[model samples]
Target: MAMSPEQPSAPRRSRIALWLVLLLLLALGGYAGWHQWRAREQAVVNSTQQQVDALSERLNAMRTEQRAQARRLQQADSLNRVLRDELDGITQRAALLETSVERLADPDRHGAQALRLDETEMLLTIGSQRLQIAGDLDGARRAYALAAGVLDGIDDPAYLSLRQTLLQERTALDALGADPRVRAIAQLDAYTQTVTAPAGREERARDERAPWWQRAFGNLLQVQPTDRAVAVQAADRAAALAGLQLEISLARAAAERRDTAGYRDALRRADTWLQRLAPDSAARTQQRAQLQALAALPLSLSVPTLGSTLQQLRQLRAR
Candidate 1:
């Protein structure tokens, strides 16, 4: 059995071949396992990178939200400060106004003076209304004098000027003279007394001047020239007198209402009636002259400074 080294036995050769095949198989298996492990590691790294990107996007969004909330909070804090300052200013103003009111409030002496001023004002207003609207001169004068008395009673030195104003108003009122309506009424009364008197003498004189034949027929049928003034008929004499009286009454009413035009017109109408009633009488001429004079009288009292005292009083009270 000791064969040469070059020519080995058959079993030994077979065993050598099997050992080489096994070694080759073990090397191939080790390479395959290493390739699989590298592939797995690469997959794990890709997944980790994707997760990190997602986390970064979420954190940025959260940071942006936080910044916006902080800005809104700052704006809200500034607005609250401004509102608080305004409220404090308003409260201070209210307190100052209340203090000023408390310092100026007075109820005793101020109340009395205020009452006097009110009375004076009321009296002045009544006087003005009486003169302008009702044309009651006497009533207006009385009211003005009473207003003066009330104004004088006010002892406030600040209102000393008001006394002078009221006095001037009184002086102006006194200077207006007597009411023309009073004179007109007196004249009318005198005229009316004469109007009711008989026209017997005038009629007899006219009859005596007529022709004898005309006079004989005068009782039955009177005839006169058309150019001559027509006398009121005997049957209508009462009504004519009544119309004349009504005209005079109308004139009086117009004067009372301060209607200058209507007063003049009514007086003119009365004069016309007077002409009809007693055309040739001396009394008629005199009465007509009186009516003309009465018509010339102005019923309205125009004074630019009439209500100056009242205006001054009101201004003082306002102050």
Candidate 2:
């Protein structure tokens, strides 16, 4: 029962060793928990940063698109405003033109005004008719000239707008007639008058000139009595028909040559001469048929658009 002191001390030592081992395990566990907590915190912070970066990029793109859209909207708005302003100006001008036309048409019109209206109206009618029926540029220009002449006398500031509109319309019509095809027929007609007669003409002229010297100087230089009343013997009906037929043939040739005026003139002369030929002649039927063929030929230029300025002026005048 009496234990030694050394045995009691041994128990004490063993107790100390167990206590030290438990402390070491607790310290190691604490260190491991701290490290895991720090790693978790770092992971959370990195994820938040990535989300913020993605959101920032999206916001920047949205901002850029919005700015571009704003610019486009501003440009479109500016364009619309400009167009509206132009439309407003046009409307105001149209109203002014209408009012002026009404005043011009009123009773107690001035002498000069009446003259101007009459001449302008007549010229407009002439120009329209020429363009519509024959597509005659020269005729249209003559009408336009007459209208310009009438406008030339107007000194009143009140008439300036009307005169300007007329000038504009004339310019529009001039542009329409600028094409060469539109003028070919009239140009050909002018050429027809200058064209020399065909081959036999030189021989006939020489034959006539052979007798000219005899008529100029009588025998022994005596003055010959002129037979002023030498009646033209009735032209042989058959020969007349044949000559008209020849004219039609020449007209066809001219048509082939693209000589519109020469063809028309020749055909017209032939038609007139055909009428003079005896109706009973056998060639009359054939000649009449030829005249019909010539009449069927198309010589008109392309129909041009009547200008809007003149049309508007007319509508304003009516109002």
Per-candidate local distance difference test: 0.79, 0.64
Q: Which candidate leads the pack in lDDT?
A: 1
Show pairs that collide, candidate 1. none
What would the per-residue lDDT of candidate 2 be over residues 206-252, giving only the tens digit for each residue? Answer: 44675667545533363423742211123344455567667766765
User: After superposition on all CA atoms, how large is the RMSD of candidate 1?
Assistant: 16.0
Cα misplacement distance, residue 123 of candidate 2 (Å): 14
| TM-score, structure 1 vs. true | 0.56
TM-score of every candidate: 0.56, 0.34
- Clashing residue pairs, candidate 2? none
Query: What tens-digit string does per-residue lDDT give for candidate 1 at 109-183?
Result: 465666778899999999999888877778889999999888778787988888988888888888877776676
Could you tell me which 10 consecutive residues in candidate 2 have the lowest summed lDDT?
A: 191-200
Worst 10 residues of 1 by lDDT: 100-109
